[model samples]
Target: MKRFLAYIHRLIFILFLVSLNGCKEKKANILPEVSVSNKQKKQVVYQVFTRLFGNTNSNNKPWGTLEENGVGKFNDFTDKALKEIKDLGVTHVWYTGVPHHNVITDYTKYGISNDDPDVVKGRAGSPYAVKDYYNVNPDLAVNIENRLQEFKALVDRTHLAGLQVIIDIVPNHVARNYQSLTNPKGVEDFGASDDKSKVYDVNNNFYYNPKETFKVPVWEPDYSPLGKENHLLEDHEFDENPAKWTGNGSQLSQPHANDWYETVKINYGISPDGKKDFEELPAGFENENYKKHAEFWNDKTVPNSWKKFKDIALYWIAFGVDGFRYDMAEMVPVEFWSYMNSNIKMKNPDAFLMAEVYNPNLYRDYIKKGKIDYLYDKVQLYDTLKHVMQGYGKTDNIPPIQEGLKDIEHHMLHFLENHDEQRIASIEFAGSAEKGKPAMVVSATISTSPTMLYFGQELGESAEEDAGFGKPSRTSIFDYIGVPHLQRWVNDKQFDGGQSTENEKALRDFYKRLLNVTINSSALAGNYQDIHLFNRKNTKNYNDKILSFVRWSADEKLIVVSNFDADTNQKFQLKIPQDIVTSWQLKTGSYLVKDELYDTFSSQFVIKNGEGTIAISLKALESVILKIQKI
Candidate 1:
């Protein structure tokens, strides 16, 4: 009997070995592919301003031609930037402003040119002033196709290095001088007789009384001047009074006098005349003129403006690009995105899409509908940076920040500084090395969604005080522009163009550590958990100086605390379940855990009974991550 039993056991062991070998063979045959499902994955995006970060072998003149500029070929990006980003192991690269936009100067008085481009007006123009939506700007690229192709090749390289590439697109308006789309008689322009449906009289009143439509110039809501001094308000007419047009032939006649910006408003059943309340037309389309225009693009026979956009989308996707950072997405109809989304995904799914709209109220509907993938978390970012830099703790104003960091179902675009904002480097902060920055960086990266960092941010680039108020303050990323320290570091024989400033280095390290932790953490990676505010009413604790939160899943947990306060130290305690104490690993700045720890007392203990309280000491302006793992 014993002999028979031993024979059976031997047979079972042989079977197990065969199965193991078969598994290995299967693993070798299959290639790894990105997840196609909507699994909650964390992504790290590195934003680049292609104009900067030059090649070492070429002439390194400041902002010169493509050759003299040192970037080599247009598609051929400098190895310096690529190598640095590749080494960091980021997920994607968002190249901001590669398109050409009209450059307009506004020197109006009373305009707050003190802030960055997004806030104040009456200054330099934005990349939003797109001259051509389909063409790449030659100023930024060497061989147009080569530059773009090479960039795509770089994307391939990045993917081989485990990263994606996303380019920016301006959908709202084009350059005032972009004749391709703006020329009154251009093939793409909306002509009164040529594309009747594309142009429409805002209200039904136009049909009942043709005189009203003919007499009134579209009265858009203009806030540019306070009266007339603000060129942006007057020129853009983003929001004007009467909110509707009074007459077509009226003196205000859509205010065509403003030449600094081009691109006229489209009447998509909204308002062109600005006289009456605008409402949607009936099913068959009550207005024949607008219908005629929509047909231009909607028509299967003609390749209209919308078709041009679709072709552009297809072109980039084929170029191996991963996504788009749409400029002025709010102004473009959601229907346009819905159509593009369906068609583009057929070619490349998981393509990251980020819109520039900062308002959730306006964008939430489309986002929920999946018309867009993400949007800039400008509102929360601005609040957090301002509060933290001021040495203030988390206040009531920061719940949106916490909510953004915790919620995962809908992702919010995160960034400390972009081409549009004031540089965070310009702000001074008080705190311990580990406390303040770690919290902010961790929150930005490990919170609810993916985040991005502008080109010079890692090197601490500051913009001019009276910088192009609304226009991009075109600066090169060669390290020497205004930041001497960064230039010195990059010029050092050992400088690989990847090291961080003393403060930025610490922040970068913290971000890397946080990323590793996030990557390894399933709970934090997807939409499996929720964030709970620990001490909400602790206004004193909620000082604009500090931020804190707890993230948890059914079987996992983590606590993040940060003190944006630059001057004062604060102490806090985090609660832990009895079982977590035994398996917890404290993840700190760029550090990883290699070994396991054990406690023999009990598999679990009672926290309320003095068993699982972890004391936290946060220095002025510092951040920490307490990671509790479950086995």
Candidate 2:
């Protein structure tokens, strides 16, 4: 009886051990619940000119036609290409030139109207001058009749590859010949129901000059439409009986040659006399959240333009577009943005809304009141960085701009190059792609804001081709030309760097490493302190040409330093402020300091008497991200 009782006890103990192991295994497989704020990854936007991204054509003729300088189709962004893009550490892909614009190509067979060369910016046309709001560009489709479906498929592929899609929403203007053929049943076109006799009305979609006739702008001495190509409609006359206000707010019947002649301004109930026809938001509406602000506009009697834009935005959102890049957002009123963006959030709470608003005074108003996700950090950070890259500005200018916008720093998106800016590798900008390396490091790591990269910027594209309507030093958004550096990386549809030069390959590899670190590091999204100012005052050999800063979170700490000097190799003892040392809770000892970007270098970080210091040796236009942990 005693032996049987002992055996039962041993069996019970073994069962208990098995049950405990099972619980342990279950707990190991379940991920811990992370807070929403802690799960936020730094966004990296890859903005590609859609038509130029896949064109393998090496023939880049000036004023080239679609057949001569081949255009990339929606089918060009194959699964392999998108996967390569995703591998570059991109979260969002801004596909520019996706909407239907007034291209000077004949597509009458597909029920699309031909655009006069006189009214188009180039043979391909300006993407900002949207011609049809309801259709995709026919020039970008494998089959002209299936353009919209092809775009939709591209959107699906982007989503499947774990990236979001962003396209343009030019709210301030439309093509001079604006027309929409596929409006959803009951919607009327702009100006279709307007009373053209009045200069401004509450419901008019445009501002008019009553009985004045419209005339095309005078051509420059050496330039003409399509490089003086003879066309049937190139008679230098358009058929508008009454002139409307030019896109740049010129009230004259004939705008200047530099004006936005291919487009017309969209009126959002703001009259020529500066009186608003729509009801303004209540004074305290700026302090409200999007849901509350949306409720405020639900019952308000808004203008026809407001409803039209709201419908247009919601349509895209429903069509699986992740967000919009609003062109010239500041040109529109803040109240209109509040109304438009609020409705957008109601449809998709995660829709990313970035805009181009260069005025610093209006940044907060656009962000807090307008509910814009991001505004171009151009006038402040970008301009400062440009001057520094050109060898005139100091690193000290960066901290003040950062301090000024500290309250809303996350909403300021940073970039070294974009479609509107000069390429970093261009002779007019930095003169060499290697010169941009340190600047890009600082731009990507200096803030918790998102970073944007132009398509060929990674491969050191100089934009040296003077493609007809577009000049040198800037990639042509107006012309259908293949980018040389980008095509090499495309490598004849293999989507590999097979044809890239060794220097170009090295540059791209550096970009891949930097961007991956930017997205994965938690310290980058945390607290920041500028050690550049402190080091400049304390450390010997530390000059204004080098910038250093510290970023830290609970789990990680980083010291980022960059030498912007193009001719001198810098060696200095970079110091961290005593306050930061205390904040990081470092005891007087040595810590392991290793470079997170490149593994070729090693150093030691020592703490003594509540101060931290590290030896830094950086070559010209070189940067290092040293991560430290207790030894």
Candidate 3:
């Protein structure tokens, strides 16, 4: 009995070896010469928090100061670093926290004043509250006086590495104590000429709180704006007599502690009643491209805030930066995006214009009327996928979400991780970064829109650090601290995985391979057809836990499927219906399909009666991005 068992095991092992060898020959032909109209320049975004990307500090003390934690400087993004980012198939690098914001650090030596502690969130301050539109962050500059020069050099270096640059444009708000000492020639700071007496003026830059003083939120115990210490600013009161509106559009004199009281909101011709004070979009301009949108704005008067932000954008464009990521974009009117983004596109037509609009109702208004290149698909796709990974939502819902956005599918950017969301590896979230693999495969291959990866996402950063005002789970955008998992890859600025564990290295390798394959494939930018419905109805024992789809161009065809069942290995016969087989023009015969990611799995499909089907067994959390070889 023992001899018979050993023989059976050896035979199984031999068969597995043979299957592995067979896939190598099959995948080599995956790079087929398919016809395509597009230049096939797909975008992959790498969002790097400037203050932490190169900070190799393991100190990681909660609410640590710049000196104690050691902040990453602008110069830290070396040629090696940018090259590494580009080699990951990233076309754009979003330099988060590039502009000077309110910080607890005293840059008085650089002639920059200290920000009031009561308003700043963490010791490093919130990046969304822009203090200087015209200047780079002093904390990021090795030499504060030469900060702009350093940033310009970084842009040059990035372009040299063949990657475009993107920086934030926080149009909705500015620091509470807004001042622009670095405002360019012929430029005026926001509210520079506002009549402080009035709360609502069409021309005023900010909404006022007549006769009321701004009250600061009471600080919770153990949470000090200045690391266990109190200052005069934290007196539970502020001095804004006739207080300004908060960043979240709160028009109250004293905003609640939960309110975005750290920053003040900008008034863009929207009144206290939510009525527009500026001109609306011209008739029939809703469906027009930015070229016509810009023309519509010509000779048309806009609010001072619009022109101020426009000039800021144009300054960055001339400074050699390639794009802008608008923060809290929906708070600012869609008309402003039409005005701002239209002007931006007029300057550089290819400038990537992405925004955060969580409301699904406004997705079309932002993308079409606002002339935005992309909007965050968090409310639909990312949210659905996150729930699915946690085993609450069904994969069956993904098809309808895709179908609903079929008209603007290419404008909805997909991401499994970003600064605002919970980390995939956190206990409160997915609990393991490995769970992100199937989701990521779906996100990257789902459409022609861009795919973004947060800095530590590739290496399973838990983001559990008690970093100042911001709590754990999501990586803190507020504090200056080291990202433990990603810092291993940073390895004290070596930018290599020398210190990473085998699992961390493997996860990163998966990300690298998947991103490269995504950008190189013609089918990803081509057409998408949902095979999930057909598979669910026709294939026996198929469950909602599995998702299947097909994407193809003139050059090649790909059948993509993912198993979100974290504990069970699912076995099913993935079917390609007669209609799809005929449309794909898949010839009649047995053809092989290989996994583009990890290359650990492959399968063969035979076309019978104008239908092609393959037997697939997916391990727990396994995803197969099988490229169908031409017969």
Worst 10 residues of 1 by lDDT: 593-602
Taking the tens digit of each residue's C-alpha lDDT, what string does model 3 give over 1-631?
A: 2123334444543343344443322211122233566577468999999999989888988888889888899888998888888988898999999998988887888889878888888888889888989998888999889999999999999999999999999998999888888888899988888887899888888989777788887666665667776765665656787799998877778786677888888989988878998889977788798889999889898988899999999999999999999986877888999999999899999899898877666789999899888998876788779888888977866776776677888899899988887899999999999999899999999887899999999999999988877789988888889899988888878888879999999999889998998888889987888788778778996798889888889877888999998899999888887877777777788988988886878899889989888999999898889987666
Backbone N/Cα/C clashes per model: 52, 0, 1
lDDT value, residue 526 of candidate 1? 31
What are the models' TM-scores?
0.64, 0.94, 0.93
Sort the predicted structures by TM-score, highest score first: 2, 3, 1
Global lDDT of each model? 0.45, 0.86, 0.84
Q: Residue 467: error of model 3 in Å?
A: 1.1
Question: In candidate 3, residue 312 scores what lDDT?
Answer: 96
Model 3, TM vs. native: 0.93
- Highest lDDT: give the candidate number: 2
lDDT tens digits by residue: candidate 1, 1-631: 2123334443543343344433322211111111223355567778866544433333333323233323322343445545566555467888765654432222123221121221112222344555555445443444443434555565676566566778876544443234332222333532222222323443221112222222112334753322233333344324222222221211332433232223333332333454323222234332233224244224333213344466667767876788988865665555455555556666776778887654445556446333477876655554445445544534334444433333332467766666655555553332223333543454453455676766555555544322222212324321112233334335532345344457656555545555555545544543221122334322234444545544444444555556565567876543443333323332222222121111111122124532254455666655655554343
CA shift at 162, candidate 3, in angstroms?
0.6
